[model samples]
Target: MYFDIAYYFRVLRHVWSLKQWPGKRGMLFRLLLVVPLVSAFHALCFLLDYVFFPRLWRQTVERPVFIIGHARSGTTLAHRLLAADGNQFSYFLYWELFFPSLLQKKLIRALGRLDALLGSPCLTRLQRWDDKTFGPTRHIHHMSLWNAEEDQFVMRAAFVTQQWALDVPMMDKIDLFHLDQMSDKKRRRWLHHYRECVKRQLLLNGGERTHLSKNPLMCGWVAALQETFPDARFVVMLRNPNECIPSTLRLLELSWKGRGWQPEQYRESLRVMTEISFESIRHPREVLAGHDQAVFVDYRKLVAEPRDTVHEVYAALGLTVSPSFDAYLRAQQDRERNHQSRFTYNIDDYAVSVDDIEGELSELFDEYQWPRLSRRSDLVKSVGP
Candidate 1:
C-alpha cells in the first residue's frame, strides 16, 4: 500500500532513456501502464482490509524466523524444509505474495474452495499456467505458486523489490539492497510497511503461528530487521563463493537475455551484483556473530544431510521437531540423496575470479574448508551446479 513514487518515477525515466528494443518496449509498457494500474488496485484492496478485517490490526508478529543468504545458496531448500512444519510456521506462498491484502486473500480462499467443489477446473488451469510460466527456469531455481517463496515479493507492488533488476537490468541505478545505508526516516517507513504486511499474513494464517520469511537480499537489512523485531531469530545459509557467485551471475544473465537485454546493457549491473554477492556472505556473519538466536548453515551439509542439518538447526533455535515433521524429514532423505542439479555454471564466465573471492573471504573459505580450484580446467568444472 506504500508506493515508492520517487523510485518508480526514477526507474520509469531510466527505462524510457534506453534504446528501443522489443524487451525494452515491453518493460516500458509495464512501467507506464501495467504496474501503476495494478498498484492502484492493490492499494484500494489494502485500504478496504482495515474495515473488513479489523482484527488484523491486533495481530502481532512475535519471534519470527528469518532465513537470509546470498542468492542460489541453500536458502530455498532450508525454507521449504522448515515450511513443511506447517503446524508451527506461517509463510507467504508464491501466489499469496501477489495478494497482500487480508481481505483479498480471504476472498481468494473462498473462491478457491468453491472452485474445488466444482471439480477444480480453475486450480488445474492455474497449475498448467504456473508450469508454463516457470518451467524454463525450473532447473535454475525450482518455482511454484503453491510453494513457500521469498517474502520480498510482498513489496513488489510498492516498487521496492530487487526483482525489477531481472527485467530491467538497472541494478547500477537502483539501491534496493542497502537498507542499512538509507536515511533513518525512509528505512523506518519501509520496514514499518513490511511489518504491517507480515502482521496481515500472521492474521491470515490463524494469528498464532510464527512468521517465517526467506529473502536473500535481506542480508542488507540485518540491522533494520533486528531493530524492528527484537525477538526475531535468524538462519544464515552459507556456501562457497566459488559456487554461489557464478551460479548467481548465470541466473541473472539468463533472466536478462530472456528479457531482451544486450550484454552491454547489463554488464555493469552484473559487476555490481558480484560485489554485492561478496558482501552478502560477509555482512550477516559479522553482524550476528555470537548472537544466541542466529544459526549458520553450511550448504554442503544442508544438501547432503538435510535431516541432520535441520535437526541441528532446530536444536539451536530451541524448537522441537514434531512427529509429523520428523516423518516428513525421514521421507526426504532418499530424495535428497538422489537429487542433482541440471544447471551448470563456470566461475570464469563472471567478472570476479576465485582469487578475488578467496582474497575477500579467506576466513570463510578456510573455516569451511571449501575446496580451491588450482587450475583453469578445474575452474571450468561445475562448482556444484
Candidate 2:
C-alpha cells in the first residue's frame, strides 16, 4: 500500500510509454486530476517512510505463507481462515495498504480513539463503502477495511504487479506472464521494494508473527518468490476454469467501468489477464511440483466444506490448528452460508463460449479433474455468482 516517490514515477513512466491518450476526452481529464492527487499522496508517504521508519526498512521477513490462485478462487476466505490463527499469523489489512506510512498509522490510531470517545460510526461507514464499491460480488470476493487482503496492492506500489493496468489503461500492453524473464538487476530491485513493503507490515505486527499473504496475481511470480523466500510455504487454490474465466471477466468489467471505459477498452486486458491466469498455475506447479512446501486446494471443496478444507490445509502446511482458530473458521463458514446469495456467477453473461473456454483450459481440467460444464444451463446450476 506504500506508494513511494519511486512507485509514482514508475507509474508515470509507464503511462508515458504509451505515447497516446485514451480516446475519450472526459476520461483523459479525470486521469489528469487523479494522477497528480495520487502522486502527491505517494510522495508524502515516501517522505514519512524515509523520515520516521528506518527500523522498518531494515526488518527481515521469514517463511511467510502465500495464498495463490486465479481471481475468485477462494483465496480471500482461505487467507481469512489462516489469519484467524492470531498467535501464529499476521497480515496486511485493506486499510493498511492505503495508509501505509507511519504518519498515516498514527492518524488512523487517532481516528479510532476519536470514534471510541464519540461513539461514532466512522469504521462502519468505511466498511459499508468498501463493500459497495470494491466488493460488488461480495460472496465471491469481499474486501473490507480490516480484512486481510492480497499483497498485490503492495506489489502495485513497487511497480511489479499487472494491476497497474487497471489504473493506467496503457499498462495493458505489458506482458505480466513473463516476470521471471526480467533482467536480474531489475528483478532484484523490484523484489527489494516488495520485501520492504512486507517488512513494514512485519515491523507493525511486532516482528515476531509469521506473515500470511494472499495474492492471485503472485501466481505468475512463483519462481521469483521462491528465489526470494526459499523457505516460504505456498497454497494454490484450483477452480474449474470454465467458471473462473467468465467470472474474472465480470470482475474486470466492473473495474473498467470505474475508469469510465467501455467494454472494448477492457477486452484486451481481459484476454491478457485470462491468458496470464492459466500460465500462472504453471509457475507453482513447476516450482513446487514434488515439494512438501506447497499445497493445492480445490475451490469446490473449499466452498462446500470450508472447515474440513481449512483443517487439511493447516495439516498440509505442518501448522497446528488452535481451538480458537478452528472456532473462528466454523463461525466464518456459518456466516458465508447465510450470505450465499452474495456469491453469484453466470457464464452466459460473458462473451466467451463454453466450448472455447473448455478447450483453452483442457490441460488444467484434465490435470485437476475439474468437471467441465459444457452447457449454459449446467454452468448456471453449478455456481451462484
Candidate 3:
C-alpha cells in the first residue's frame, strides 16, 4: 500500500528521456500503463483484505529465517531444501509474491480449485507459459512460478524492487541494496511495507509456520533486518567471488540484451553492480560476525554434502529436522550428484580482471581458500548448483 511515488516518477522521467529502441515502447507501456493499473488493483485488494480477512491484522512474523548471499551462490538450493519441510516453514511461491494481499491469494486459490474441477485447463496453460517464459535462463537460474522464490518481489507492488533493473537497466539510479544507508524515513517505510507483506504471507500460509525468505540483495540489508526483526535468524551463503561476480554480470548482460538494451546503455549500471557484488560478498559476514542467530554456509560444501550442511544449519538455528525432512534431504543427495549447469561465463567478458578481484577481496580468498586462476582460460569455468 506504500508506493514510492517519487522513485516511480524519477524512473519514468529517465525512461522518457532515453532514445528510441526496440524495448522502449514496451518499457513505456509497462511504466505508464501496466504498473499503475496493477498497482491500483493491488492497493484496492490490500484495503479489502482488512474487511474480508480481519484476522490478518493479528498475524505475527516470528523468528523468520532469511537466506542471503551473492547471486549464483546456491541460495535457491538452500531455500528449496529448507522449504521441503512444508509443515515447519511457509514461503512465497513465485506467483504468490505478485499477489500480496491475503484476499487476492485466497481468491486465486479458490479459482485454482475450481479450475481443477474443470480439468485444470487454466493450470495447464500456466505451466506451459512458465516453461516458455523461464526456459532461456533456466540454466543460469532455475525458476518456476510454483517454486519458492525470492521474497523481494513482494516489494514489487510498492515500486521498490531491485528487479526493475532487469528491464530498465537503472541500477545506478535506483539503489534498493543499501537499506542501512537510507534516510530513517525512507528505510523504515520500505522495511515496514516489507514486514506487512511478510505478515500477509504468514496469514495466508498459516500463522504458526515460520516464514522463510531468500534474497541475494538482502546481503546489504542485514543490519536493517536485524533492527526490524530482532528475533530473525539468518543463513549467509559464501561462494568464491571469482565465480559469483562473473556469473552475476553475465546474467544481467543476457537479460539486458534480451530486453533490447545495448551494452552502452547498461555499462555504467553493470559497473555499479560489480562494486555492489564485492560488498555483497563482504557485508553480511561483517555485519553478522558475532550474531548468535546467524550461520555461514560454504558454497563448495553445500554442493558437495548438502544433507550434512543443512543439518549443521539446522543445529545452528536451533531447529530440529523432522524425520520426513531428513529423508527428503537424503533423497536430494543423489540428485545433487547428477546435477550440472550448462551456463558458463568468462570473467574477461566484463570490465573486471583477476587482479582486481584478488586485490579487492584478498582477505576473503585467504579465509575461504578459494582457488586463484593462473591463466585467463581457467576463468571460463561452469557455474554449479
Worst 10 residues of 1 by lDDT: 376-385
Report the C-alpha lDDT of model 2 over 96-200, residue by residue, as the tens digit: 876555566667879899997877698778768876877755555666777788765755543455555676554355655565777776566666667767777
lDDT of 3 at 60: 85
Each candidate's lDDT (Cα)?
Answer: 0.88, 0.71, 0.91
* Model 1 ranges with Cα > 4 A deviation: 381-385
Question: Roughly what TM-score does model 2 have, to 2 decimal places?
Answer: 0.83
Top candidate by lDDT: 3
TM-score of predicted structure 3: 0.98
Clashes by residue pair, model 3? none
Model 3 lDDT per residue over 1-385, tens place:
9999988988888788777766677788999999999999999999998889888878888999999999999999899999999999999999999898889899999999999999999999999999999987787778999999999899999999876778889999888899878888987898898999998998888789999999999999999999889999999999998898899899899889888788999999999999999999889989999999999999988888999999999999999999999999999998886788999888888999888998999998999999988786697989975
RMSD per model, one decimal: 1.4, 3.8, 1.2
TM-score of each: 0.97, 0.83, 0.98
Q: How accurate is candidate 1 locally (lDDT)?
A: 0.88
| Per-residue lDDT over 92-118 for candidate 1, one digit per residue giving the tens place of the 0 to 100 score | 999999888888899999999999999
